[model samples]
Each structure stands twice: as C-alpha cells, then as structure tokens.
Target: MSNGRKNSMQRVSDSPRLLRLGAGASPARDKQWFCNPGSGAWPPPTIPGRIMMMNPDQNSDPLFDFADADDYQRLRDLLAAAGFLDESVLEAIGINDLPDLASDHPLLLDRTAGGSALHTLIRLFLMEMPVEADTFAQAIRPMAADSWLQAGLVRRHGSQVTAALKLLPFRNLILAFDLPALLQTPQRSRYVMGIGGSTITLSQLTIRRHCRQTLDLGCGCGVHAFLAAPHSSRVAAVDLNPRAVRLAAFNARLNNISNVDCLEGDFFGPVAERQFDLIISNPPFVISPESRFIYRDAGLEADSVCRRIARQAPAFLTEGGFCQILCNWAEKDGGDWGQQLAQWFGGSNCDVWVMRSESLSPAAYGSKWIRHTEFSDGETGFSQRFHQWLDYYERLGIASFGAGLITMRRRSNGTNWFCADESPERMIGPCGEDVARGFALRDFLETVQEDAALLACRLRFSPDLRLEQQFTPSAQGWQVSGSTIQLARGLAFQGNSDTFMANLMIHCDGKRTLQELLPDMAAALKADPARLAPLVCQLIRKLVEQGFLLPAGQENES
Candidate 1:
C-alpha cells in the first residue's frame, strides 16, 4: 500500500510486462526500475491438477516426452541390450548430449540430446516395482503412469514440440522416457534429485502483492527463475556455470516463457542495488572444500552460501518485501542453527521459519556428495572427492550438519528479528503461504502491540486458517497469547476494553471520556456513528484495547 510500491507494481505489471525480466531491478532498497523488455505475457503452463510440481508438461508445448509402461519398458530393454543403460556412459558423456551417440549403445552417443538425457534420467531415478511380480520385464518401466509424459512431447528441436522433437533421438524423450515419473517415484530416489524441490518450496512461500522484480540466485537450470517469471514484472535468473545458463535459457524457451532473463554471475553482484518484492533460492548448501561443477557444492566456505544469502536478502527486499531460501548448515560444537539464523536477520523486522528436514554427520555428508559424482565412473576420483568432503568437514571442526527451508520477510518495524525451527510434521503439501503468513502476521502483531499491552489476551482461532495456539515473551517485555487462549471464544482481559485501539491510546491521556473518544474513532475510520458505536460497544463486551470493560483480570495471564 506504500506509494513507492504502488507505482513500482503498476509499472511492472504492464500487460506486456512478461518479457525478459529486468533481473537488475533492486527491490530491496530503491523503488526505481531498470531495464524493461515487454514480452506480451508469461506463457504460463496449463496445469491439469492442483499440484503443478508433478506436471512436467508445463508449457504451451512440451518437448520432453514419456512412454507408456509396457512400450517404454521394451525401449529400455533394447537400450540396455545396446549398452545405453550402462553407468559407464552416464559417467563419461554427461547426460545432455544425445544425437552423436551411434555406437552399440546408440542411445548413449547417437541419439538426440533430449533422448540421450532421458537415459540419465532413468539412471538418476529409483526404480519402482513393476505392477507384476517380475522385476525384469525385458525392458524399462515408464516409472509412472503420470500424464506429464503423455501430455504431448515438449518442443524438441525448435519452437514447436513436434518441430523440436524432429528426430527419433528427440522423439524418445517424448515416446520413451529414461527416468521414472516424479509422482510415482519413491520418497527418496537417487536417480531423480536436484534443486527442483527447493525452488518449488520457495515459490509457494513467496509473498506477491505484485512484485516489481525478482531474482533467483544460483539458478540451476533456471527452474526457479521460470516459476518466478509469472508473478514478477521482470525476473533475473543467475547461475555461475555457462552450461547452466544455456540450459536454463533452453528450459525457458521450452516452457514458452519469455520473461526470465538468464544471467551469469555470483550472488548480489549482478543485481547491485536492485530491490525486489521477492527473492528465492535453493543455493548450493552441500558443504564441500571446493564447489566443484557449480551444481552441488557451496564451496570450502562451509555454509558461506547460505549465510551470504541470508545477509544479502534484506538489503534487496523492499520495506514489505520477502525472501525465502532452502539451505544446509554446519552445526559446530553445540551451536544451534536457530541462533545463527537469529543473527542473520540483522535487526530487521524479519521472521524466519525453518524446517529441519534432515541432519547428517560429517561422514554421511561426505558420502552424499560423493554419490552425486557416481555417474562419472571414476572409482578412484570418486574416492578422492569423497575424502575431500570428509577432510573439509574435519578440518573445519564440523561434527554434524542440518538442512532446512527458510523464509524471511522485511517488516515495517525497524530491525526486529524472529527465529524458530518449523515442525517437519506440518510440512505438508506446500508451506510457502504458511511461511508468508507467519511474517505478515508477525508484522501485524508488532504494530498492534505498540498500541496495547497484551497482558491479558485471548485468541479465537478460525477453522479456515492454519494456525496454532502459542505465546512467546519478548525478553520478558511482551508475551503473545497461547494457542489455547487464541483458540477460545472469549477474551479475558485485565479490564474491559471499551474502545478501539487508536481511540483508547489517544484518549488514554486521561482527560477524555467514552463520549469524547467516539468522535475521533469515527473520524479515523470514516464510519457512521450508529454503526461505529455498537461495534465499539461489542469490543467492550469482550476485552478490547482499552482495559476498562472485560472479565476478571489475568484470567489466562502467564
């Protein structure tokens, strides 16, 4: 509602605002916009279900294709017999190239890039049991009955799906998939892993009251950037690897999304002074001595990527903007991750919600990164990479590490900070909106508390809202109402609150009576006296802001 934000949103939301996003617009500080390339509109993916993540064919046209269970299985068997399914090819060739593969494992070197990549797709995903008893059906299983595969192939060689998939090599991605369906895959599949989940999670939690610009730092293959393109006037997608930038661009083209501007740069440098309404990232959290391949490792800095992301976000978020991230951190000699997060807020009225999804010791962490390189087929080098991870952790004195999802919101209040670990039990569906509400509500609470001491407070939770009864004392100065009180129907105030919050506080100067406060209250709200009087009276029926008309004092005071 701020003037600056209003103008920014208006300018960015042009009907033709869906062009390549101006990734450099700093939404954290200045309200001004930079480059604006007006593409008609975002080519949003038409989803068949409420769950967009499972829908891979999220485009006007889809280039990647999937096969039916029986036929796809037959293709897999043929490829395996031809050596295309071997791990050796996966390790050496890199999965993206397909057309050149013509040897015995033609799928490995002679097939089109998209189709060749499909083989790696299978190699990366976990195998689902065949519906029948026999695990080996002489061919590859489609891995899923998902529609993303059958929805029609993604554009193959060029702009159109059929056009892009002009050749047999490309057609395989459409006709014969390599990986299992994401929806059908088991909980944790080695074959299907990457930054997809993190980006999706962050996207759900982003606050969009109309974002002028947005940025996806460390945008691997540009999936996150693509998602952000729809809501933002302009979007900037950045990654360190040239190949990643190319792939991200390719993905954008495939998705028919023109608003995302893929850039090559490290965090915050390319987007200097550009503030945004939202910033999201699934940065490299896997702690490694060296950030090899730029795909997984966060480098020798040990949580440096996460820390930098946290530290830099506030600088770019507008007064009411927000940033969300997923990261992994080292737990040093009893140091709690929550404490570190608290410090990261930098006194901004920021609320941080983190869900500790998993924790692993130094050895376990090392092995996970080691396995990512398994496709390389160099046993000795794999061992070396594994040892490097262990050495990095040991030398840094890391005992255990934790990984989690985080969302931060910049509030109107100056420099207030909140930190807590979210319950994994409640991390269902998508938690983006829940996280955003936490920040927005926290901001509202801070503003409200300034007018009244919640010494005696109660909360009557609504069924429609996802909330819990909880209270916290801020350095023993102020305490919030507990879930029990908030979930109840009545207010147990110290005294009857006979007036609106602003009315009560203003007239609390001790000279004005109820009659005297009515005029100011009506004027502030611009409401009629008849309607206003009863509303103010009903507030007193329970305890309102002014502590003069309620039940026994301290009824539920902690």
Candidate 2:
C-alpha cells in the first residue's frame, strides 16, 4: 500500500492537471483547456484520441423478416407491377384458399412464419408459370406454350414469365429472368453457402490491385460486385435477370456501398464498352439438359459458356486489363481443353492462363446437377432427366468435363500459356491468384500436361531449428521427422522451391537448441535472432499447429 501510494504520488507529480470545459461544452471548443492550472505544464501524450474507435458496426438489432398486412399489401402492389403476380390468376388459383394450395406445393404455400422470393405463394405461383394447372404437371410449367395446356384448372399465375422463371426449378423451364432486389445478398444461404468451384475460382484468380473500372458479368446476387467495389474505383455488375439486378442493387445498399451500379441485360449485348481495367465472370456454364435456369444452365450449344465469355470479355477490357473467368468446357474431337481455350483467343496477342483446377467424370457431374434440381430423388421425371444427361454425354464422347481458372490479358507482346490442370494431392484454400502472376501462370500452364502441379510443394525443416530425427524416403509418403523443441515448437518447414527446401534441410543440425544455433543461423541466413524472431515465431506457431513441434513449458521461456 505504501509503495502504491508512492507510485501514485510520483504519477501525479509527473502528470499535468489540465483545464476543464464547462458543462455541455466540448473540450475541443477551448484550445487552452489542456494547460495544467497548478503546474502550467503540457500533457504527456501529443496524439489524443489515437486509441479511439474508428469503424462502428451499423446494425445492433435483428432485422424484421416477416411482412405485416400493410407491408404485405405494399409489397404485393410492387410485385404485381414488377410482373410477379396477376390479380385475375390469383383469383382463379384461389390465393385465399391457402390450405388447398399447400397440398400441391407441399414444400411451399404454407404462409408460415416467413415470406421471401422462395416462399409458399411465390414458389407455387412461379412453378405454375403462364397458367398453373392442377391437373397436368406438364401444363403447370410457366414456360409451356398455351397449346400444350389444353386441360382443366389451367389458371394463369404471373403476368410476366420472369418472376416465375426466378423461382422455377423444373428441367424444362427457361432462365430468362433476374432476382428481385430484396433477395440478392449473402444474408441468404442461396448466395453465400451456395458458392462452389465457380465462385471460389473467380474470387481468388481475378487481379484487383491495379483495377480502376471493373465489370462483373452475370453478377448473381452481386457476389463479385461486393468484392470488386472495395478494390476498384468503379464497378458495374450486370445480370440478365431483372430480379437478380435488383437483388444486386439491394446488396449494394445493404452494405452502404455506392460505387457499384447493377444493370439488367442479356450477355454483353447490354454491357457498355471501351473501358475496364478488368472483367470477371462465372457465367451459366452448365451445359443444360434443358433450358430451365438460364443463369446456370447455358442453352447455347457446344462450349457456349466458354465461347460467350471469350467472345464478350475482350470488348470491355482496357488496353492492358484482363478478363478472368471460371468456365466448364469440353475436350472435343481429341482437342485439348487448353488448345480449345487458346483457339478462342483467335490469334490475338492476349496471354491466356488456363489451369484445369478440377475434373469430374460425366456421371459425377451429371448426378450433381440432377440432385440440385431435386430430379435425382424425385418421382418419375428425374430418372428420365438423369438418363438424358447420360445420353448427352455419350453422344458427345465426353471422357470428362474440366473446370479451372482462366485469365486473359490484352497485351501485344509475346504470348505465353500456362496449364496447371491436375487436381492437387492436397490443396487447402486456393492457388488461383498465385497462378495468375504472369510468370507463374505461364509456367504452370505450360507444364500442366504432365500432372505434376498436383504435388508441387517441397517439404523441409526450419533453418533456425535443429532436426531431431531425420527419415529418408520410404514406400509410404514422406517419412521424415525432426525435433525443434526450443527455437520452434515443431520440426516442419515450407519450401516453395526445391533449392530452398534442400538448403533448409541441410541447416537443420541435431546439435544445437534454437538459442544456441541463433548466432550461426544469423551468420548463415544473414539475419540476427532479434531480426528473425517474428518470422521464426510465425513458422514455429504453424509447425506447432501441424503437430511437428510442441509447445514449451512456462518455466522454459522465463
């Protein structure tokens, strides 16, 4: 207590007693307020408010999800005008008879606790399309021509086909519409959790550093737009579906982002030209068995997604800008996927980096799509759809489908190609951005045919730590062990290049603890222990996490 008092008095003697502001007056209003009345001294710290908070979370409460009667009516009016619902059809289909509708739309039409683009009323209406017929499932198709529905209970549901298209999961439906503004965000699992190879590839591969103006083609829910808006000065995301466009706009507003402008258009036909540092897309590349979701299942025949992206991306890209995309393409007539993509450049001076990131057997790919639409487990039509896919694959002689990161830079200099096509033996996160560097891209692409990018990493031990045990190559995977208890928690190290890996392994001596070996490592690696501390700490942490190193006892560090 005496020592504490002494410290307190010392603090008081060293500190200044600043002037006070009057009640309700900001301290900033009085410039001379900082002066101590007793000591007439300056404060110790120069930069005030340095420790203050800058960024604040906007939402503190949960947002409302259900629509009230008044809000519902307002939404109903808006949707009606947006071509979502037809009054006459609503009457005919008996929207008032909610219980009856629930029987048909077993998964939907319950008018439950929530309402959304995929709610009971919306899904049922969207599925039933031009006229929802209770009698014929075929006639219930929103896109089926009138003549196909010469039956009873053919009730018209939506004034416009786009609304119905947005919700339809049927194989025969057309994907000519967009998502509405309300549902386009990561807040919905339909956008965020739904991400696959296509989304990840685009996110990682596309270069964002130097871009000023960028375009996100077919920006569903504006996922890419959200990413691009922060990195670039201006980004324009365009989607063919009106609903998707509105959803994209809604996403922008929700994030308080103003730089992204969402537009509705079909392909590059609606996109403005002659300006963009980069263009990115994950277009509807799935060669569809039917035209159902135009956003995903490309209707155009034969490498349509790849061809369209290749054809349109060139128009908007700046002189030195690049177009990066993830596309599904066929290996046709003994033609390599790389060669096919190269031909798409049409002898231009553009450099292409096509790394076949993934490959799947026709059956596996076909089954996945079938399950997505619920066709695989559905009653009767699903089997037909599955067989139809098999027939399509057989007819095309498609050994397997390939998907990967594709980057094209508009440079008039030398053209270089990189191919890292094989699936990795063990890949955790991503290699797309790394693969995009011009040198890396070209090197990987050129060397990919041999399938070695799959196992490219060279494992080694740390330079600053001792190798406790060494194991030579055996019949199994890498059978090597080393102890790095003091300097590091683990024995593992990373070497991207072979020479570095070899050099690191050579330095892992069994004799020295990390502290004892510090001087030698400092001399050899040209950095002192203090200088190398941070790097060593990080490497040690990673090694500990991987079980190559163990944590030290508390008494050891002291």
Best prediction by TM-score: 1
TM-score of each: 0.50, 0.49
Most accurate candidate by lDDT: 1
Error of 1 at 421 (Å): 1.3
lDDT of 2 by residue, 305-421 (tens): 567677667666777778877667776557666666677777555666565545667788777666664522465777778789889888877777766556777766555443333
Candidate RMSDs in Å, in order, are 17.1, 22.7
Question: Worst lDDT window (10 residues) for model 2?
Answer: 1-10
Instruction: Candidate 1: list runs displaced more than 4 Å.
Output: 1-195, 347-351, 375-387, 444-452, 455-458, 464-558
